[model samples]
Target chain A: MMQIVKPDFEFKKVYETLYPVIFRVAYRVTGDRALAEDLSHEAFIKYYERRNPLPDLKQTKYWLIRVVKNIALNYEKKKLREKKAYDKLQFKYPHFTQSGEAEFIKEETKSFVQKALNKLPYNLRIVLVLKEYAGLNYKEIGSILGIREGNVKIRVFRARERLGKIIDSDAI
Target chain B: MCPDNETLSAYFDNEIPSPWNKRIADHIAECASCQKRLRQFETIKNYLHEDREPSFESSLEQLEIRLAGLKPRTERVSLWKRRVAVPLPAAVIAAICIMILGISLIFSLTRSNLRTMSIRRGPSGTTEVQVAAPIEDLELLLKSLDTYYLKQEIIITLPEDSLFNITGEAMMFREAEFSRKRE
Candidate 1:
């Protein structure tokens, strides 16, 4: 008799296959390893928690992308709240010791590129990472981000343009 | 008119048709500003394309260990059921934690209401007095009294002849005073 496999085991296999990609995407989005792992795990848990199975791998990927995006957005909001609190405390007391070491790395062109990318709006970061690191085409990124393909293309192009200017300045 | 930004973008992407591509290329070549812009775009693209991957094999081992800590010991079974099982408890636990945290916060805010009551023997009757403090501190005080006296138990002999009204959050000791005699 053919043994019946459990849905949970099948779900684990699927998660294992996709976990690496999801981790990379989450890491790029959150810019923190621990946060990336947390977001990825949360995405997986949410994905599996649904009573109905996902329609297909394509849909699953889309769900993962959306979940991670929301998680990263919430994390950003929390960070902003914490920053505001810290600033308020510092302004009031002004006697606390600042944490961590300050180091100056070499002045490389890559630093300029990084600075330029950071200067872009968060929406632009989403588009660029989706296209650049995840290697999703314009239409796929659009579907993932719920924007029109033309919008995705336009944003990415603008991001690249801004980045190019910064890079060229550093190069010269 | 100068070529539109989309056309310029298309030219950067190498997506414009051949004749249009040549036209844009010639325009960019002649225009130092546009040439610089194009070169800048190329540089950004190069930086973006540069591989910045962490060593996944090493990361994967760490992930494996982290996952193992949370993995259930059950053999291969319905993943669908397993997936459903996982988040339900997480949500439930989160709700429970929120409830506990909220209660603690409320308690901390209103802790001044916590009270302690003492009964002392008097000539005509027992007099009951109250002071405010944490229940845990009250219990600790009682426990220490028992230990210091080295008695099998500390019996508060209430004379049942005086009327006393005490209002406090932790009035359970009054009930305990009544309960001990019955026992």
Candidate 2:
């Protein structure tokens, strides 16, 4: 008899295995702990509901990271659509600014950083997030993103250059 | 002379080739602007490394409970299909077949002589006995048997010498019982 394995068995095991990595990835992208937790939960639920096959832990982590990135991007787009000022950098660095003008300047600086991070296309964002957020090395990121290590290095370099320009412009 | 961005990035990443690595170090030492840029990259690295880990502790219990509550649909279906439905099905089928066959044989013997015959003239005006056994629609017959009384016999009676297709005979009795059960 050909037996059909219940998808939930695989789902539970996969969630247990990849949850931490997914949570961390979401946190890095969204820059909010609670939202990251929720996003990771939602991602797992969505993956489970799709009857996704249980991949090896590494692949699952990569998939989870990708899902979190797409979701966070959509969220940012939605904020932009809503025309909320804080939406530009909704998760700002909590370090306080003393003067009102200084606070506005800091806010603008953060906004510039957010906009730059958002502008770097999915290709660069994936590499940058893998390197800076998930802390994956070039080889690991190359495998996850299906690119050469050299390509990964170049992409990260370009991303950092763009980010530096954005921050430097705001400082001026 | 200062190194380019790519070389500087590689130098910062600690992946530069030996001679180029030494060259970038020499440039950083000689050039204040390049040194400041190197410090900036170092700051970026520190900020990245200083990222706080997110906590999922509050949601863990709920997530676990939900996951636990999610009984795989195949498992439930399989449990019923295998544990309950499989073991005694053959026996049930056997019992049903036997009961149907016995009742059909008894009924057939009682009504065997009541079959009607008909004759029709063709173009040649020939006469023939068209002996036709009236075949009851089993489904319809079973549907109408609600009015009839059933003895509910413990032991089924069978003829001493029976020769016929047992399947058809069993079907007849099964139909009759099904009809009676509707009442």
Candidate 3:
């Protein structure tokens, strides 16, 4: 693993190639395009700063995936807290648009699959997205999440099974 | 013998090792329970990897904007770590700070080049660096030191009424000698 400490390192090519893949994993995990974009941008920024520490180009990409997943997880927690505060606000100060519950129900119908995916626990959801969308193997995902390869396999399987059950239950 | 659920799932991804991989393949071929589980795994993997990630054009645009505007690696990371909105306010503040610091560094480095420095010896004979910089440079240094200010109080007593005694004696002398001369 030769050190790549070049003053003119070409990071643009890597960014272009990796953005789509990282974005998909983040989007799949969080189920929001805007949030995913933020998460993806954050991961790339982190990679830009820490690219030298990684041993090689391949490790750098893996490091990007790992950082993206962790950032997404942290983003999810922060978003959850914001949502709780928002719900409390809504309860205290009841403001409703003419959009109404019926319109909300209609909108929910359109994103049923997404809602189901969001329902899956974050740990399972993260492993599933990284494996399926990020296209990382068990060892790679394990290295990212700091878990065992066997555990990664089991989580991925459980995530898929739970997703299938949810989809079947909803018949969407 | 039946493999564990994790091992069976690993087979779908072909994560099983050498001898175990062959054994699982042979076992799944003959065993109905493992075969059923394998089918379930396949069904789920197919559904879970469904291509549902929404497309956003903003990804590349945002990246381009950042790459175009990147000033320096250290400053970029510091600004970004504090906030991800990528606002220019922090960058502006950071640039101002760096400019100030650079000027200070240059000032210190060029200290030896100054033709004259008025050194004031304090009570202990230690010299104080009252820098004789250009007015603009001095103002800049003063502005940078705006935060730390010290306050003090002092009292001064004025000599009062000692002149009254002298004035009284002079009047007495005038009344005695000068009055007689005038008369």
Error of 2 at B111 (Å): 48
Better of 2 and 3 by TM-score: 3
* Worst ten in a row by lDDT for model 1 chain A: A100-109
Error of 1 at A146 (Å): 2.6
lDDT, each prediction? 0.65, 0.63, 0.69
Q: Rank the candidates by lDDT, best first.
A: 3, 1, 2
Candidate 2's residue-wise lDDT over A13-132, tens digit each? 788777877776776566555667778877876666543354487677777776777788787677567545444444473453336596466446433344455556666766777787
- Give per-residue CA lDDT, model 3, range A1-172, as digits (tens): 2233332455776777778888887777877777788888888777666634455657877888878777888888897897787778778878934446874774464365677788899999888878777778899989999999878988977887788788888884
Superior candidate under TM-score, 1 versus 2: 1
**Model 2 TM:** 0.48
What is the TM-score of each predicted model, taking all chains together?
A: 0.53, 0.48, 0.60
Candidate 3 residue B177 C-alpha distance from true site, Å: 81
Runs in model 2 deviating more than 4 A are A1-13, A50-52, A84-126, A139-155, A158-172, B14-36, B69-183
User: Candidate 2 falls in which docking quality class?
Assistant: incorrect
- What tens digits encode model 1's per-residue C-alpha lDDT throughout B33-140? 777767766666787667464434555556556555653333444545454435778999989999987887776566554454454434343444443444435456
lDDT of 2: 0.63
What DockQ do you compute for every candidate structure?
0.09, 0.17, 0.15
Q: Provide chain B TM-scores across all predictions.
A: 0.30, 0.32, 0.38
